[model samples]
Target: MSKRPYLIERYPPSDRFNHWFVAITFILVALSGLALFHPAFFFLSHLLGGGPWTRILHPFIGVVMFVAFLALALRFWGHNFLTGNDRQWLRQMDDVVTNQEEKLPAVGRYNAGQKLFFWTMVISILLLLITGILIWQPYFAPYVPIVLIRVAVLVHALSAFVAITGLIIHIYAAIWVKGSVGAMTRGTVTEAWTRQHHLDWYRKIKKGEIRGHDHY
Candidate 1:
C-alpha cells in the first residue's frame, strides 16, 4: 500500500507570525480603546499600565496591527475570495453543519464561512483606519472639522465593535475545528485533518506537491 501523502503546508512561517502579531496587538488595542471609551470600561486600562499609557499606546498598537493584518490579508485574499463552490456551500450549510462532507459542496483553500469572515474583517479594518485617522487627536483632527470628527468617532466605535465580535467568532471556530490551532501555532495541520475538513485543498496540495514541515 502506498503511504498517505502529507499536505497542509498552507500557513508559512511569516504567515503564522503575522497572525499572532495581529492577534496580540488587536487584544491590546481593544482593551485600551475600551478603557478610554467609557468610565465603566476603565478597568481595561490596567492591562496596559493605566489610562494615560493605554491612551498613548492604543493608537500606536492599532496602527501596527492594521499594517500587519493588511499584509496578511493581501497575502491570502486571492485564495480566500468567494467562488461558485463557496456560494453552493453556503446554500447547503445544513450539510456542512451535519458534517456530511460527501453530500456537501467542494471548497477551495477557504470555506464560505471563512470567506465571509475574511471580507468582514477587511471592511471593518478599513473603516477603523479611516475613522481613526479622522480622530487621532493631534495630527489629522486639527485639520478636519469638529462635526466630521464626531462622525468618525461614531463610525470607529461601531466598526471596532463589529470587528471584535467577528474576531471572537473566528477564535471560537478555530478552537472548534480540530487541528486548526495546530496550523496557526506550528504552521501545519495533520494529513487526516486536511483530507477531512479541506479536501479540495488537500487534493491541490498533493497535486501541486506541497508537503508539511514534518514531511521535510
Candidate 2:
C-alpha cells in the first residue's frame, strides 16, 4: 500500500472556525455597510432585506465581526510580531512576486506580508468599531456632539475602504499561494508545502520548538 503523505497541522479546528466566523460576519457587514454608504450601492441592500433593514443590521453585524476578529487576533497575536527576517522579506518584494523563494529569507508560519495583513485587519476593524459607534444613530450618536459625529462618519468610510482593499489582497494572495487555502480549510498542509513556503516554521516543527495538532 502507498504510504500516506506526511502532513503538518497548521491550524487546529477552533482557529479555522474562528477565522471563518470573522470572514462570514465581515461579508455581511461589508454588504450592509456599502448599501448604506451611497445611492449607487443601494441595490446591495436587497441582500440583507432592504435599505432600512440593512441599516439596522449593519452595525450589529459589524459588532459581531469585531468580536470574532478580536478572538482571532488574540489567538495569533504572538505569531504576527515582525522579526528581522520578516523585515528583510518585506524588503525583498521583487523576489516574492517573482516566486524566487530561495532568494528570500526563510519565512515563518506567517510571512511579513501575512503579518502586515493581520495587523491591518486589526487596526481597520478597531477603527471601524469605534467610528461605527460614534455615528450610530438613535442610540449613542444622539448624545455625542454633532462635530465629533460628523468627523466619525468620514473616518468610518475611510477605514472601511482600507479594510475592503486589504481583504481583496488577502483573498487574492490566498488563491495565488497554492495550499494556503487548504491550510485554513483542512487545518493541515503537506510536509513539502510547509518546507517550501515556510522553511523556518518547518524547521521548528521538526525540532519540536513548535507543536501542532499532529505531525507525521
Candidate 3:
C-alpha cells in the first residue's frame, strides 16, 4: 500500500477565520474609501449603498478591519521579527525572485519579505486610524484645528495609498508562491511544501521542537 502523505497544520481555524475576516472587511473598506477619495471611483460606493451611506459605513468598516487585523498581528508578530537569517534573505532578493530558495539561508515560518510586509501593514493601519479620527466628520474633526485636519487628510490619503499598494503585492505574492493560499484556506501544508519554503520550520517539527497538528 502506498504510504499516506504527511500534512502539517500551518494555521488553526481561528487564525484562518481571523485572516479571512480581515480580508473581507479590508475589501469593503478599500472600495468605500476609494469612492470617497475621488469622483472617478465614486461608482464603487454602490457596493455599500449610495454615496451618503458609503461615507457613513466606510469608517465603521475600517474600524472592524483594524480590530480583526490587530488580532492577526498579535498572533503572527512573533514569527515575523527580523533576524540575521532574515537580513540575509533580504540581501538575496535576486535569488528569491529567481526561485533559488535553495541558494539562500534556511527559511523559518515567515520569510524576510513577509516580515517586512507585516510591519508595513501594522504601521499603515495605525497611521490610518489616527489620521482618520482627526479628519472624521461630525464627531472628532470639529474639535481639531482646520490646518491640522488638512494635514491629517493628506497623511491619511498617502497612508492609504501605501497600504493598498502593499496589499496588492501581498496578494500577488500569495498567488505567485504555490501552496501559500492553501496554508491559509485549508489550515495546513504538505510536508514537501513546508520543507521547500520553510525548511528550518520543517526541521523543528521533525525534531519535535515545534509541534503542529499532524495528518497522514
For candidate 2, the per-residue lDDT at 37 reads 91
Alpha-carbon lDDT of model 2: 0.92
- What tens digits encode model 1's per-residue C-alpha lDDT throughout 1-216? 887656457688899899999999988898899999999999999998998888778888889999999999999878787888888999888887777878866667788999899999999998999999889876788999999999999999999999999999999989888788988887877777877887787787778755443573
- Give stretches of model 3 more than 4 Å off: none
TM-score of each: 0.92, 0.98, 0.98
| Candidate 3 C-alpha lDDT tens digits along 1-216 | 999879999999999999999999988988899999999999999998899999899998898889999999999988998999999999999999999989999999989999999999999999999999888888899999999999999999998999999999999999999999999999899999999999999999999998974886
Per-candidate Cα lDDT values, in order, are 0.86, 0.92, 0.93
RMSD per candidate (Å) reads 2.5, 1.0, 0.9
- What lDDT tens digits, residue by residue, belong to model 2 across residues 55-167? 88899999989999999999999999999999999999999999999998999989999999999999999999999998888789999999999899999999999999999
Between candidates 1 and 3, which one is better according to lDDT?
Answer: 3
Clashing pairs in 3: none
Model 1 residue pairs with clashes: none
Error of 3 at 170 (Å): 0.7
Which model, 1 or 2, shows the larger TM-score? Answer: 2
**Model 1: how large is the Cα RMSD against the reference?**
2.5
